[model samples]
Target: MLLHVSPARVGFFRAQLDTGRSGLVLCGPKSLQQARRLRNTEHFSGPLLVDPAVYEVRAASGEEPFPDVAEGTFGFEDPLAVSLAEQRAVGVTAPMTPTGYLHAEDSDALKAAVRRVAALDDPQVVFAAPVDVGWLREEDSVRQLIACLRLVRGPKALMLGGQRDPLAQHPRAVDHLRQIVTEVPGAALLRTDLAAFGALAAGAAFTAFGAGSRLRHIVAPGERAEKSKGFAQSPHVLFPELMDFFLGKTLADRFAGTAAPVCGCAACEGIRALDSFASNAGDRQARAAAHNVAVLMEWLRTLTALDSGPARQWWWYERCVAAVAQYPLLNAQLLQPNGFKVPAQLKRWALAAPAAVTVQPRADAKDYGRS
Candidate 1:
């Protein structure tokens, strides 16, 4: 499985390449434009995919072609952006969950949203996450979500999206996805955002975790709004699993060192000490982001190397479940299969919405809010 990590900015691409992890996703013109300058007009070799910013599909109301885009044109129309995407990207995607998560039972609603994406002639990938699937307590709901994926054909990548931060959305998300591609011949499951690496063991062809704190966590599809203020830089350290963010310079320093939990990614492994990651300026934030990706890369490499057999994917599924369940730190972030119940508010859409799931908190993190 290829673990594609996002660049925190155009500047971090080299750090990733220097580490030998490729297929860096250019978030858009914004990230791409800057990357170009940083490279001094150099070209990136691995497959580049453009996130067309269409993750949300319109709801069950009147269906239209990407209703969320301004003036009905996806920003991909920017001549410069289009040229760059076409020149560099393996493909471009319409947001898989443009209308947000759909109830597992709401097949009609899902078809309405997915039809346009399936019909597109451009090299495309389906980027969707079943709504409210995290709190899923019933097995039938899982079957229904798999059915929705089974319906999609002629696809490039089956990217799983829409889970909020720090919570395992649908515990069976990776399993069902593994089953889908096994039965369907065209596409491979590509999971993104929180817990994506875990999905890799469950059979993701490619998986990505957020490169920065801002990109790491997401509002549950149902709860997100149209607008929000940009986040200011803060002193924070990315923990293992990329779920929880511990905010504070002291905490960052304490956890970052050869003796600490930090991984030996290409970027930070060379840094001599954690104290060097002081929180005085953007340097701290950049280092933190690089460190997060580095550790994530190292972690993924380990998973990929665990088994070489045909059953390798299942090798991960079993390994991660047993491994995380015992490790207090991992359990603090992710959930074990059939582990816990989700919040009442989050569970409201579990069986009813077009997409949904719910999960309980780890023993130590009972105070964490379920998004």
Candidate 2:
């Protein structure tokens, strides 16, 4: 799928996106206009925008923003906004990010609002899980996610959330979320938080990270507003290439003896290994970005071409799971010892860090994905 990793703003970005893929994810703050523009670009058949409320959470520690909406739900927009997004072939993704509780009443109010957002019948509406919730609270988040999923029962209705278990640091979240994706019937897409991409090998589903690393390769978070000229400030900074590399490597290594093909895209077609491309900063960064995108597209194409058979199932259960399980061990390789690439390294660090255990594992690990 054609995935446009962009910030949440509509007016900020002006880049030419690659659109041959099947889907697009607009990361960052939510913007109806930006969503429409993405749809107009044809890079994605249907674009999914991560909600703005994720950044509004107010910390008890007394951060700058008192009433933090960082973990808040998207109740500000009306159904018209969602409809407008549809006009541009983009979809709206709302729901909580799962952070600290503001108030019991407010939480309930937010839950009610989520239900209302899901109730809207539009061509593009995906109710993703709250991004702010702690992984230790997966049960609560899952319960809330289930409620939102129930309201949006159409074929387009998809579910999304960050991870909470096993590889909660890296690829484990993918496997954990995969259980939800597999079990959550009718789920069209899934999303991973900034930290989970490296070892996870997650898919066309929602993926977000810092902006500088992907589009402009911004070094400092403070430079986002000033330096982000032709790009959105949202999660577009975090492109899908992070996870794509993991998945592509897994596919190449696991199914090595089989007909599993290497990506024919410009990046991997004539290349031997990922290291063949110049991945260093400056001129090298662009080359790495190009190769990363190409490799990702190739993986998605192969995945899309696969038949819905036992092999696919086995792939998800075995290789996919194994890759995620390896997140903790493979994390060091995700980083470069060199400086100037700090931003990307930080994001990878988040994905590889261990998460506290909270949710009770189901009887069978397979139950995680059984619909």
1-371 per-residue lDDT for model 2 (tens digits): 33435544222222322344333445454444566554566443443544333322332111211233323447664433433344344434332222222221234534554554455554244443333223314455545554444555442222222222112334333434444444454444323323223222223233332223332111111122233232231112112222333222333333344443333455445544433322233444344445455444444444444433332333333433444444443334434233112233333344432323343222233321101
In model 1, the worst 10-residue window by lDDT is 362-371
lDDT against true structure, model 2: 0.36
lDDT of 1 at 59: 30
Off by over 4 Å in 1: 1-8, 18-21, 28-40, 56-62, 72-105, 120-137, 154-194, 220-245, 248-264, 270-282, 306-371
Report every candidate's CA lDDT. Answer: 0.43, 0.36
TM per model? 0.61, 0.49
The residue-by-residue lDDT of candidate 1 on 141-233, one tens digit each, is 555555555555544344433433323455454445445545543444333443454445444545555554434433333455323222242
Question: What is the Cα-based TM-score of model 1?
Answer: 0.61
Scored by lDDT, the top model is 1
